[model samples]
Target chain A: MATSEDGDFLPLTPVAFDILLSLLGGEAHGYAIMRSVQERTGAEASLHAGTLYRALARLVETGWIEELERAGSDESDERRRYYRVTGVGRRVARAEALRLENQLGAARAHGLLGRA
Target chain B: MSHRRRAVTERLYRALLLTYPEQFRERHGDEMTRLFLEKGVDARRRNGRAGAFVHWLSGATDALRNGVGERWNESRQSRREAGTPTANARRTNERGGGGMDSVLKDLKYASRTLLQNRGFSVVAIVTIALGIGANTAIFSVVRAVLLQPLPYEDPQELVLLWGELRNRGITHFPTSPPDFVDFRDRADALEDLAGVSTFQASLTGDGDPVQVDVGSVTPNLFSMLGIEPVLGRNFVEEDGLPNPQGALPGQPGVLPGIVILSHALWQQRYAAAPDVIGRSIEIGGGPAEIVGVMPPGFELLMPPTAALTPNVDLWTAARLDYVNSPRNNVVLRPVGRLREGATVEQLQAQVDLIAADLMIDNPIKATAGYRLRVENFAADVTAHVRPVLLALFGAVVFVLLIACANVSNLLLVRASGRDREFAVRAALGGTRSRLIRQMLIESGLLAAVGALLGIALASGGITLLLGFQPADLPRHRNRSHRWTRPSVHGRIRYRRGCDFRNGSRDPDVQVRTRRRIEGSGRPLHEPVPKADQERGRRCGGRVVARPADRVRLDGAELRGTEQRAAWIRFRRSPYVQRRPSVRPLPAGHRSSGFQS
Candidate 1:
């Protein structure tokens, strides 16, 4: 069940949703996230420095993602900050995915998905 | 593949990164730059220059779009977190705190009051307009001609060496070949010396006959100026030797009759063909081969009495031998570059000793009152106009201050009439600071509008001034068209970093563009313009060499036109303006004037 607090953020914008989706894979730096997101939805609509960092800032604010300390898995790890999705982020992503699924269901019932 | 060109691309990107707000830039700037460099190098390696060009074309847009977006968002976010602005005035209507909040309210209220007093507002704005407009016009000329540093290497170290006849009261007379040789050989403190004589001649053969200014220069003149030919080789020392009669073109000890084309003549006649180097041309109706082409905007500036025109269309080496030339035939106007840690005063002392020796040795010099005077090249060039410019600058400054004071007096008078409103607001619990702030905001609004109007008028005035650029005005060849902004922003930026009284920054809320290209990623060996070399030092490394690369890259300041156009687009961007706006005025309240 989506708590009322979490429900306020239900209909996440495409960029916020994509950022949360990219973080589903363990942890990554800014460039890595940009690369992964660009791979998913081509470089034509790119996540540049300003946009990527702003989305990251907003995500950190919403507790959807967290900045992490290097756990020393790679001993030579430099100042490249790594970020990962949080528990609340996972819940919000699940809620958003379900909402999208419901919309797809309605589309299917209305023969809008080329399945009629 | 030119790695230097690649480095220029990176340095430019780093300068562009200034568009982001400081905090956000601090968090991710280095990482972003590293990523950009890595991608740029990769793109270049994989697909060559065009691929890299395409990549950066998108990359530039991405950076500008996102950077401006982030800036707008940051301002809104900070305002929200800090407290209510005027939009939320009703929320804090009774409370007398919130610095920025109150300031905005005062601005809004002050604007309303000014609108109410139409006649007074018009009078005050017009007064300020005359003051600011005239000041701006003069400042443009002053900044262009006087303040603009001479386009050369270490211009301050460069000085004009002149022959002064103290007995006759002529200070800037030309020097003879023998005198020049003496100065050149004996003046150890002087780094290098070069002499030039200019004369008008008919240049024929390319298309039509045209009169051209020819500079008969010594061989060392090109090296002394530190300017290389944009194409072909500079004149060798042997080139200055006389071309004897019936001399073979390539025979040993025979001089080649050659001349270097000024950039203007080359473009005008030859259509800027690169292959014109070895082509035969006629100068002063005598056959000469074109050897080289000077860089665009290169000219020799000398004192007026030197009688050398600033624009020398053709440069031919002087064939007159310096060692054996006639002593009394004074023709060459000599200019010298100073060695490090040498001053004109120090040079004067040393030259006095040499002159005394010359007087003792040569009876002619003693009889003729031949003495030497060293002057800073720029100062000597502006000798006739410097005092006049200074006087004019002083007058404009006084006029502006008086206008400000006049407006200040008018404001006081207007404030006196608003006493009942002030009393009522005070009785209703308005703080003293609020009343004062309201009055301050009113005057500020009037001054701001006046300045804007003044900028418009000044631009018109500047066009007129530049149109008639008085014949005697020094450095009229300064190429001012490229540097002219002709707007209010131009003056404000001209004043920046000029406040010597305060070597410190304001402790108020910081603005965007705080870190202006103290490049963490300075592109090594990148080619920048001569104008940008001083600014390039701020980015670190000796990157201003490689004159072969004419690709000029001026940093963020040059982007004013695009930046402003993009600023309007960003301001209107829906994502940037998503936050609630300042509440709109009620139907009649906007024009109703402030009611007690």
Candidate 2:
């Protein structure tokens, strides 16, 4: 599922967790989101051209992401395609965060977080 | 599909199909491309041209990427399957240790190929030889004329100071002595200034008893050139003083003559004596003391105009009776080294100011001239010869171009014959790029052999030039014509009168010697005009080297032209008329028109 911050997480290649983490903020163009994801992760992750575009197409088709009508401006050289998270995308993102929080709490209860 | 449509479809299929690696291409490239095109065209009809382009592009890209990836993976897989122990060992060696092995192997193979194709190798070598030889010859001339440094310390600092006579509209002339003196005193940039003049001296006491070229110079001449005497010492300040009636200051009756010999003269005449200093020799009709010998290849700094031989077998400082000596005598050619941190332009500007001051003092000599300009010694000497050298280079380049065209045609023929071998190698996994590199290496090998032959040819050429050189060279730039031999004998023979060998016997010969006119300067032998000569006696000489019996003459005494011709007709005689072919002309020998 796609979310607002998923644009930022798009560049966190091959990692579903990092992608979800980055999409927590707002909508973005594909290239803009890829750059944001790379910057946030300190370049530790990079998305291949094929994989990134393919993932975007699949997300749009699944209705988790909605395409926005980008404003036509004099400065824009090409069709600046934009995307945003839909209602289903937001719901999926919240559920993912909750699932991760539960997993982390279990680890803390077992004392694994600070165990020597 | 019709044949045309099917052909078009196949073409489109082939474009996408060829993206596979060679290993895959041979096995299944055609089948895969056919399937992709069939599916792609149907998609294009439904989705549009842009859709079709994207679909085809993606298919081609994926195929290429996968094909290369599969090859790499398969090679790795085979290594594991075979459990090849040497694989890791070979990889370790290949990291650095075994690199030289491959280079040596390539070189050895190239050498073998060259050796096998002897005819092609020889022709290629000859072609390269001509190219390299022509280049070397032109470069040597260029080096002599341009590249080599002048024979002086910091030669770039040395400049020929010439006065431009602005009023007279003449550009360059030797600076007047007084002007040189004025500049030396006033100029702040000059480190040293000197002047030189040509004079002939009779080497009376020398073994050969001949005339030698002598240079009269100021005390600072050799110093300005940054040269030192190889023997004894250079001119001291005291040697420049003029003695009354050419008498030595200390030795009352004897003239105070001091002379410095050139290196070549010293070696030839003095046998390179160590104790050449303080030796007394008679020169210019006076006893002069040998002060020192100069280094070899030291030519006086002057433009070689009119083939004037360098009048400098020895050197002497100009005497100090200078107050009375007219500085207006524009004879001396001056050269000077500028001080460190001074450029030629700066020196010239400084000299110009000095020249202006002198112009005020002597309006006639100085008003006609502007500031002095400086020229480099090497450039001043070789500037005129540049055109001749360039012409020679152009001729040689034309020959080289012809040689290259011939070689290229030969190589193309050889390549056609070797096409079968190349095809076989290609089939056996050799790539096109590797084959081209091998052929280039073969060309390089041929070029190397040609270079060796070319060097030998160059040496022979230099020897030929040295052999028939004129007696007096360099001084006489037009010696080229005189240096040429008779077309038949290859021996240097001149017309009898201009021959220097007979300078003593014949006064006419002596006149020719003094003139030193080279290249067809001989006078034609003709009968003296009847009005110009008075008859004393009739002289007769035997006819030698007779021609065939075809005697014909014209005179007013004949009744008619045809009657005279009939009377003059003669039959072939049984006895062959012969005389001595070559003999010395007798002391009183004279020729007549009617020789019996």
Q: Model 1 chain B, poorest ten-residue lDDT window?
A: B496-505
lDDT of 2 at A64: 65
TM-score of each: 0.57, 0.48
Off by over 4 Å in 1: A1-116, B1-106, B245-254, B360-362, B467-469, B477-596
DockQ of each: 0.30, 0.01
| Candidate 1: tens digits of C-alpha lDDT, residues B175-275 | 78877888888987899989999999887767788898899999888888888999888988878876665554445656545799999988988889999
Q: After the best TM-score superposition of candidate 2, give how far the Cα of residue A22 lies from its true spot, in angstroms.
A: 84
Question: Cα lDDT for residue B464, model 2?
Answer: 55
Best by TM-score: 1
Report the C-alpha lDDT of model 2 over B1-596, residue by residue, as the tens digit: 35686577567555544443465455345435444554456547767777666766665566656554555554455445643334533442345432443345445777776676676677767765665565454545455545566667888778777777787876567666666777777777788888777778688765778888888888788877778988889987788766676555345575557888899889888899978889887877777889999988677745664133474698878774555557677766777888898887888788877777777877786667665777766677666766666787677655554544444434533443343355444444344434454555455445555656655555554445536533422323222221111111111111110111111222243233334223223232343333212111111111221222211211112234444354334212322233334333322221211111
